[model samples]
Target: MRISMWVVATFLLAAVSLEAQARALTQNQQSVCRWGSDIAAGAQASKLSGVSLYGARKKLQVRKFPRPWMRMTALGITEQTYNSASRLKPAAVKQTYYEQCVRHELARR
Candidate 1:
């Protein structure tokens, strides 16, 4: 009886933890999506001004937005990084990678 109770308690705890993790992951994903969108917008603006990916990355560094935002922005600066890894390769490949990375981060969240 005691063993059965322990097992039940453990299962409940595990279930609760899983729920918390899922919620946290959702929040992280949303945050990433927002940040990625912001970074992409910024990159697009830079591109209009004839800024290269390397230059854009430097510009984003100067802005220093925030975590995930900053990271995503930096990620948006490297065209090669996006081309090598991302399967989708959106027109704005750098920005797409930034967004995908955000999504990936969320999935792991």
Candidate 2:
């Protein structure tokens, strides 16, 4: 009985691990993740160019360069811009955005 229980537990654990590994982002999810990364980069660019967060947002809107996910990411970056301390780095922000977008996409699926 003990051996059988151990075998079943191992099998269930392996199945769960395989299912997680098998999951991959779809094209749409990839696009959203890319957009999120882009938004974060854009924030860094705006900072480097001496543009305010509001100005950067306006430029993006005028160019119509971002999707909904990008807009959301940008908004978060903009909020960070106002805070003098604890300002998020562009790469860190990008990673966060990408993860969130991927998770949201996965949940939708």
Candidate 3:
């Protein structure tokens, strides 16, 4: 059970790595970007503990996040960002996402 959970977590991280950069995303998109990157970081941390991201893709499991639907949207964003910049490392990708997310959040304040 624990192993599966870890696998799911790692898979989630794997999917979440790589965010959009170079081009700007709308505020709404940035919101999702932040969330997905955050989730990816958590997932990466979980992997360091030997967790895998194999089983966490299901909606029921995704409810661990505040908004399950949003998480699904995050997956889409993560995938798109990752594909757009496959050459970049995950850490760099997360940093870019973080910067954009922070900027978007700060503007609202």
Candidate 4:
């Protein structure tokens, strides 16, 4: 019974970790979509983490507008951005581009 409990706890921890990672990735995706080159450039120049920037944006969003539906809008924007940019290559490539772009932007700052 102890072993079973341990296994269950381990599984729960893994699930939670995966969920948090997914949330972070989704937030980054939304930020990339909404601000695109601008945010990426800023992040790169400022030497800031993309996830941190996204968190700041989220805080600003809640302070200015308390609508929960904004999350849906972010999702929609990410989808559109992905669809439009993925025409020439895979989505992963575009994601990498944005990540690198952020780094470049941060470097400048």
- TM for every model, in the order presented, reads 0.41, 0.54, 0.41, 0.26
Clash-forming residue pairs, model 1? none
**Candidate 1, poorest ten consecutive residues by summed lDDT:** 81-90
Q: Looking at model 1, how many pairs of residues clash?
A: 0
**Model 2: per-residue Cα lDDT over 1-109, one tens digit each:** 9999999999899767544633577666687677767766667656766788678777766665434555555677655643434356677666666666666777776
Q: Give candidate 4 misplaced runs (Cα > 4 Å).
A: 27-109
Q: What is the C-alpha lDDT of each candidate?
A: 0.56, 0.65, 0.55, 0.46
| C-alpha lDDT of residue 82 in model 2 | 39
* Per-residue lDDT of 54 in model 3: 48
By the lDDT metric, which is better: model 3 or model 4? 3
- Please give me the total number of clashing residue pairs in predicted model 2: 0
lDDT of 2 at 76: 74
Predicted candidate 4 versus true structure: per-residue lDDT over 6-107, tens digit per residue:
999998997676445434554655464435533333333322232343554454355433446554554444434433423333344445555554454445
TM-score of decoy 4: 0.26
